[model samples]
Target: MANTWNTDNAGVSALASGDFDGDGHDDLALGECREIADENIDDPCGPEEFAKGGGIHVHYGNATPGSFGYRQQTLNQDTVGVAGVAETGDRFGAALAVADIDNDGRDDLIAGAPGEAIGTRAGAGAATLLFGGPTGLVDAWGEGHSVGYQQDTPRVPGVAEAADAFGAAVATGDYNHDGKADVAIGSPGENAGSGGVWLLPRASVNGSSAFTPAKLGLPSPSSALAYGRYLSSQ
Candidate 1:
C-alpha cells in the first residue's frame, strides 16, 4: 500500500530520509521552502515578515508501511533545537542534509536557509544543526546533551554577508579521513557573485572554542564564477 503526506504549502521543495531517531525505522524530512501568505490582508506582512521563512517537518517511520503515523515534529528557525529565529526571506528549508555530524550513533539534521539575513546582511543565508538524542531530535543548546551548531555561532566559522546565500547547498563526508563526518556549505553570492564554500570540520562543529573555516573560492581572474553554487564529497 502507498501513503501520502501533505503540507499547507503547494510545493514540497526538498525531501530526505534517514533513521533520524535511531529507531532503525526510516524517517522522512520534508522541506517547504516558500511561505504561505494570508490572503485576508492586502499587505499581510511588513518588510521583516514578508516571506517569513519556511519549515522542515519530520515524520518518524513505523514498522508498517502506509501507517507511518503523524508527523513527529515540525522544525524551523524558531524550533527549540534550532539556533536562530525565523526571519523574512530566510527560506529555512530550502536544502536539507542528514548525517551523524557529532559522531554520535544517532543521525543529525542540517537545514539550509539560503535567504537568511544576518545582522544587516539581507539574504546572507544560514544553516543549522539539530542533534539527535535518546528522545529523538533535540535542541542544540537545550539541556540533556544535544549537540548543536549554527553558521552564525562562534563555534562555527564565517558570518553571513549580503547576498551570500550561505546555505544554498550542503553535503557531508569524512573530508579529513576522520571517523566523524564533516559539512560543506555553498555560498553562491559571495565575492560579487564569484561564490565560495566553507568547510566545517567535525572537530570544529563539536568543539567549544571559535575557529576559522577553510574556504574554497574560484581562482584569481575569474569573476562571477559562483564556484560553490553546488557541492558533493566522496
Candidate 2:
C-alpha cells in the first residue's frame, strides 16, 4: 500500500505527533471525523471544526519520503471481542499524545475522544492509552499484547470542572521526571466561557508481558494557569 506522507484527510479532523515508540521516531497521529465549517470548505482554522468520524490512527516516520511505513495502530468504540466496554458511537480520537512512561524504553499514546456536542456536530470526547512494544504496537485487542485506559471521571477538578466537556489532548514530558512521559488535554469554551486544561500522568507501563496504561489529571488551580499548562516538548 502507498504510504501517506501528509496526514490531511477529509475524513480526519485534527493531527498530532510525538515519539510514541521512544525509538526516537516521531509518529504521525490522526483523529478521524467530519467537519462542520460554516457555509463550507477552504475555511481557515482560526480554531474551529475541520473534519469529522472514524477513530484515531498513528503512523511512524520522519519528514522525508519513505521515513514511515504503511503499518498503523488504532482504537475505536468497537470491542475486539472483549467485555465490560460500554460501546460508544460516532466517537473519534479528537486529539493525541505519545510518551515513554515508566522509561521502559517503549512509547505509548494518549487519545481524546469527545462525544457529540451541542450547537455543533463535534464530539465532547474521552481519553485513551496505547502501549508500544518491540514488534511495533502492543494493542489491547491483538494477540500477545495487553491494554488498559483511564477510569471514567478520572478527575481534573479545576481544568474543566464546570465545562462538562473534554476536548483536545496533548502529551507532555515525564512530570515526575521518572524518565517516562505523560498526557495533557485542553478544554476550551467551558461553561463559564473561558477554557480549562487536563493532564494524565502515566504510571507503570509494561510488566509481566502486558501493557498497563494509567491516567492522571492536572491539578486545576483556582486561578488562571498557563495555556498548555502541563504540556512539554522533546
Alpha-carbon RMSD, each predicted model: 6.7, 9.5
Cα lDDT tens digits for candidate 1, 157-209: 65557897887776667777767677777777876677766777762554322
Task: Give model 2's clash tally.
Answer: 15
lDDT values, one for every candidate: 0.62, 0.45
Query: Lowest-scoring 10 consecutive residues by lDDT in candidate 1?
Result: 42-51
CA lDDT, candidate 2, residue 78: 46
Candidate 2: list runs displaced more than 4 Å. 1-9, 17-26, 33-53, 60-65, 79-91, 116-124, 138-163, 175-179, 203-234
| TM value for model 1 | 0.74
lDDT of 2 by residue, 42-132 (tens): 4222223223334555676755655654456554444352111323443445555556554567665555554533223334444556556
The TM-scores, one per candidate, come to 0.74, 0.55
* Number of backbone-clashing residue pairs for each candidate, in the order shown: 2, 15
